[model samples]
Target: MTHTLLEGKKGLIVGIANEQSIAWGCARIMRDAGATLAVSYLNEKAKPFVQPLAERVEAPIFMPLDVRSEEQMQSLFQKIEKEWGRLDFLIHSIAFAPKADLHGRVVDSSVGGFTQAMDISCHSLMRLAKGAEPLMRDGGSILTMSYYGAQKVVSNYNMMGPVKAALESSVAYLAVELGPAKIRVNALSPGPIATRAASGLSDLDNLLSVAEGKSPLRHLIDLEDVGNLAAFLASDRARAITGGVHYVDCGYEVVD
Candidate 1:
């Protein structure tokens, strides 16, 4: 019997909502590789969905976390440290923008939407990275998800593009700052993938078709693809790779 890539490791997979979730894919693969799991769902309303998924993966706990709330961030990681002593990895699979904001032009994006979008999508990454620092004393990887729209125009993505741009920037900054501690920070800028979150935005199905056409592979990205890459980044295989915004976008960024 042989353990695998993530053997002896443990991770916190935040933002899981359901079985179709990107975080759920990452959670499944990482667990398969032998890392233990802790999940974080936003509220009571989301608990039923997140709980069963966590149970399926043998995740020990599913705590409440709303990243916008600093109290929740601190309390959540404190629980991790108390129970697990420290962490080996963390996935910030959270991002949000109001539906109205996603439908409107960026120029038409309001002050509230801009604040909420950036706060939830970008700043939350920064906050989580900082919170994870102390408990990552043995050195850990912090990974976040981004999209091509952060670099180029993607209609109806609207304010989220800017939020992701800020997120990518934060990845660089956090990587450099956490380097001496032996922690890595990076992002996976994935191409279009159908998930519960993506379905929330308007015109996504049509846009996904366009993504398939533009992608060199002539196909869409999948949670498994992103999951494999994420596990690699969170492991010692990526020891020297920090501050990188790695793309799993099927070369879609190349053309556009």
Candidate 2:
């Protein structure tokens, strides 16, 4: 029997596009653990996709959200407050880097591409964490996803690597800023996993092969691993863990 890890928690999970999305995995597991889910779709164009995924996760509150705009972020949170009053957790499973930047050399990355990538991929979490703070009456967990490219060089990762570096740093700073309030902030960094997001990177084929072969697990990272990790982080089990950029990468980081 699967015991409900989050028996009475309520939280928002932003950025699930489909079942293959890491956000979807988190939502599924979070729901299974008895958490009520509030989901945010990025835009109208995404509504069709987000609606179905939210249904599958049994998410009760679904709203439109675009992290690039403060208005949308504030509006979404405002609605959440009106409906739920308080939130127990927040999952920031959102990130984006342009296809052009991910397929070329870092030197070839343009100013526009770099800014767009960082704004959407990194700044969004900082925005959400700031926005979610007031409503977490009971100190709760805030989670964001990160990739291995942030710490080590991965060919064709481009500007997004720098963005993830900034995001990883934000986890620490937010952890410090929110710690006194009992809020925990952390990032779950995972290795290669085949999903729509990974499709943008040209090196995905070889990247997965190398990660699977060299990592101690000798297998590609799985979404189940990520979902379970999310459940643990959101629960009181990890109350003492904060501001950490924890690796869920099947021992890949330890290998030289």
Candidate 3:
């Protein structure tokens, strides 16, 4: 907790819904490590949920960013450019799928649903990276949230499996493209937690139970564990690490 690894860094944290959000966890840790932070609320509806947390982190620039809207995303970055003048790190913890597409089989998913899922969950990272690149004058780190389902099938994971797979692949490709600028990209694949997002998945209680039994740690991971890892990756300690899908899943991926 005494690490001043990011003392002089400036970062953007997107997709915090509430205190329980993974993005919130990363934000708190990044703030504690002494980084100046900026945060985005998805819209007016999400603003209430994110405001208090932003205050807690003392973020100077809080703005609205809906990745689907080029205007909104541009405005958010424009604000960043005006305020911070540069960006050192970014954490993308956003993903979404219409309930129908999320609950149904991949083959049964509608084109609209599939496209929306891919756009929000996978492609938005690319959009954000493009905007952040020019501002990362010295170099930076980009981290996105992912899950085990992206690699192997998990019952009830449905269409998101493919979506997250695409996300992880994007991390690899983006890392290669950005490496020359010293902009590192990585995907953090966390184990299931009872986050608001996970509540959308079918039979999540069973998944958690099974994961606990299967994982080497024998207990589910929590936000703090996630925060610790995220802080490390964003810090200079991880300067050499990039283009990897690092797991914070309590060894569950190794089981079976």
On TM-score, the stronger of 1 and 3 is 3
Candidate No. with top lDDT: 3
- For 1-256, candidate 3 gives per-residue lDDT tens digits of 6559799999999999998899999999889999999999998999999999999999999999999999998998999999889999999999999999899999999999999999999999999999999999999999999999999999999999999999999999999999999999999999999999999999999999999999999999999888889888988899999999999989999988
Name the runs in model 1 displaced over 4 angstroms.
1-3
Best by TM-score: 3
User: Which regions of candidate 3 deviate over 4 angstroms?
Assistant: none
Q: Candidate 2 or 3, higher TM-score?
A: 3
Worst-scoring 10-residue span by lDDT in model 1? 1-10
**How much is 176 displaced in model 3, in angstroms?**
0.3
lDDT of 2 at 168: 95
lDDT of 2 by residue, 1-256 (tens): 1557898899999879877889888888888888999999888888998899888767778988889888888888898899889889999987787788767777888888888888888888888988999998779999999988889888777677888999999899999999998999999998888888887888789989999999998998788889899899999999999998888889999998
Q: What lDDT score is found at residue 79 in candidate 3?
A: 93
**Candidate 1 lDDT tens digits, 44-69:** 99998888888888987568999877
Cand. 1 Cα-lDDT: 0.88
